[model samples]
Target: MMGNKILRKIVATVKSESKGINYFSHQSTAADSYVYSILVDETSDISSCEQVSICIRYCNSQFQSQEDFVGFYATSKTDSFTLYNLVKDSLLRLGLSIDKLRGQGYDGGANVAGKISGLQKRLSDDYPRALYFHCAGHNLNLVVQDACQMSPVIGDAMSCLNKVVVYIRDSPKRWDSFNTLLASHEEVSGCNIRPLCATRWVLKLQSVDAFLHTYEVILDFMQTAHSEKSNSASMRSTAFSLLRKLEDFTLYFSLRLLQVLFKAVDPVHRNIQSKTITIGEVLTQVSSLANFLASNASFIASNAKNDDSVAHFTSCKEFASKLHLNFACVPRGVRVSAEDYFCGLYTGLFQTASESILIRFQAKSLQMAENLRRVLEDESIEDGIIKTVSEFYDDWNYIDILRERRQWFNICRHEGLQPSINSLRTQFKSELTYKLLLPNIRSALTLYIVIPATTCEAERSFSALRRLKTYLRSTQTQVRLNNLALMHIHRDDFIKKVDLDDAMNEFIDRTTTRRNKFGIGNK
Candidate 1:
């Protein structure tokens, strides 16, 4: 029963390895060429312990962008004052200079993103160049969440789907039963079930799509559970209620509509997660998606039957033609015609998504980032725009700014070279104002490149958080947990480079008995 004396040493060695690998990644920020951005988000552990994740995005010596999980801070208070101080101390510990921070991104929590006293406001006060923007990915999720709020049917359907998936997955017998059905049912033989994510709604697309394909099988399973006479009365009642909700036509249509709608927003949502995606690019992609939804809304509106004359019912007719659908009651307590209700719902979804996107993206924080985009992609050079760009980086010397502007116009002449911020950084080595002499231009470009567009990577670290700090490992110390999380999030960046044999030997002398056998300090 290796009661784990040796296992403890292995864990200790892994913790040391995590620390060494993370410190190595931290050295990238020590570069004279590095200007980094901060991404901070607070999440609780399984034990409900609140901690903040601090990630820094910067371009490495290779000029490739990196968003590295740098540290975690545990604190009792999450107020902006406490959080701001915690962030400062964390950076100081890592030996990263506050002067090098060029941007800051976080979700729209009032304590974090508020203009007056929020963390962003505090950060921008001291580090003016650390411009703030609402995280683009969270903004997209908010768009989906806002649209979901508009339709009660969507809310109800989400509840039903989420509960049913959890109900089955909670019990091993139920999960195994569901798996057996998936294997046997021909309509969705190989399909899997995914629970709807509670935090980010855009991620719910996969969960919704999975259940849609497996809907029939789930229905069959529920039907058997409800009808089985030997089942407990409470169990049968619960199963019956869930089954009725599943069988509702409104819920089914909501699921179907959400499938298509989520698919519509998927591309923009996905593109926003990129490290190099600027606010301008995200706005462009969002505008395109909004236009697509608008077109679909128009099609749906004109095709559905209305109170006037005869209508085509093109979309509704097409969808309902294949399967039987019931005319369900709306919130007003009257059963409406299938042609009108579903079409209106479909059009409403498109309208909701488009409107929410347009409204939410018009934030004041994005104005500066948009200005940077104009300088990069816009052919017509405007002095006013140049002033805005230079003012954003007001820390730069005036002479350098003047020269960079000349180099900038010259670079703009080669229209073909204007693609992405990253590509431009690469192209600059040879042609940035006559042999890359523009140091300010290079640094400015690096600054904008490192300014993270979204906090998606920080959110990704939360998944690792759950994996590393499960209930069984709940007793792990905070330092140990942080080390393990940094290693887990950044394993690919440094795992292959770790010298495991040396790491083991370094941690081999933990216990006195083991040290005696190893002859440590015997000489």
Candidate 2:
């Protein structure tokens, strides 16, 4: 009991600024903590290749208020499951649910997978039409990865180059020397020796000819390094590997490759600011790109073969099988059924696979469904449970105005029904409406949007963690570290009543004071 009290107090203080919660402990793994799940719908645009995921809870159409966070549990042991449970529990503690969910986006890892048991499957089972979308950017990556692999030499080159980067970056002195040599090059070497970022390399592949012009400068730098230490076989190997890799890179980046890259970047540019994109948009874009690529492959390949230095472009015969696999996974371009989509979205987003299990809880003594069934069949389903479900189904269908043409609802003032309709609208706007609609809409939106999406939105805590654990300072206990991380999440909530900027500034100042007092940066 004493330990428990102390632990609680420590967590409270950590949360004051760190704004995160730790769930790896034995306590968090309990059944109670795993009760709810979080869902997120994600979309990746093929044109620009940016992915966005949205977290939400179900409520009536009129419900439009936003919650700071929502909480739920994932039904599995994967990253998506862990992320969903943590985010959902945290948000629920603050009074949010799936009713507020709007969209979801992801790049489709096992944790973020949109398939069944994948985040999408889980979310759709709970929330209907929560819009499980594949990331277009990821599909493009697959295309590029396949294209690169088609030429074994290119694949080897990329692998070799990646290793070279890792080796140099790992050795600070070597990396610094490499940078210095580039900066000191007397002619046309004024360009900064930029850090080898992954995305930039992909872009470089589109213009291999431009890079080939500067290959000599890199070789000169390698030669100079080798001359400085004649006994360094390691240095010679690195230089030779880098040259070989560049050759393969240049060979692979012909006009065909450039066009394919352009297709992927276009969609990413369109939705850089959006928090989430729908599945329909992603499927449509990918399908179009695949069709175009398939049709133009022969022309592109013919041009590649004519280039004297092209050496090896991915052949049409070799690429067709991979393209077919990608095409098979691409969602059909036809309009998906709104009702079916919504049902799957909610179920996958909100409800855990094990949700229907009662565990130790007994069945309700009061019978409600049978009584409501009569009213549902005969008289109009008014503003009760049946009415809540009815409104939820219709509201969900209308939420994604992008799916179909938007149509306005017409409430004919049929005397008594007018008052009821108005009352329903008013009730729909309430928080209670979200709670009531949970049962019906849970399957459609919960699994995909709620369960896979996370509330680990502590932008402040990440900053704090970086400050605490820098490249120079990297020793800490796992327990203390967990406590510290949790503090980051709580800190966001703690300062909700205070000015966020002021709190962050104060926290920074405190860290600066500690650094100065400890003489931490006095090199």
Top-TM-score structure, candidate number: 1
Instruction: Assess candidate 1 and give its lDDT.
Output: 0.71
Listed per model in order, the count of residue pairs whose N, CA or C atoms clash below 3 Å is 0, 118
Each model's C-alpha lDDT? 0.71, 0.37
Per-candidate TM-score against the hidden true structure: 0.81, 0.45
Clashes of 1: 0
Query: By TM-score, how accurate is candidate 1?
Result: 0.81
Quick one: best lDDT, which candidate?
A: 1
* Residues 343-454, model 1: lDDT tens digits: 6777777778889888988876677777666555454657777677777676444456566656666765666555456556566644534323555555556555666788
lDDT, residue 161, candidate 1: 93
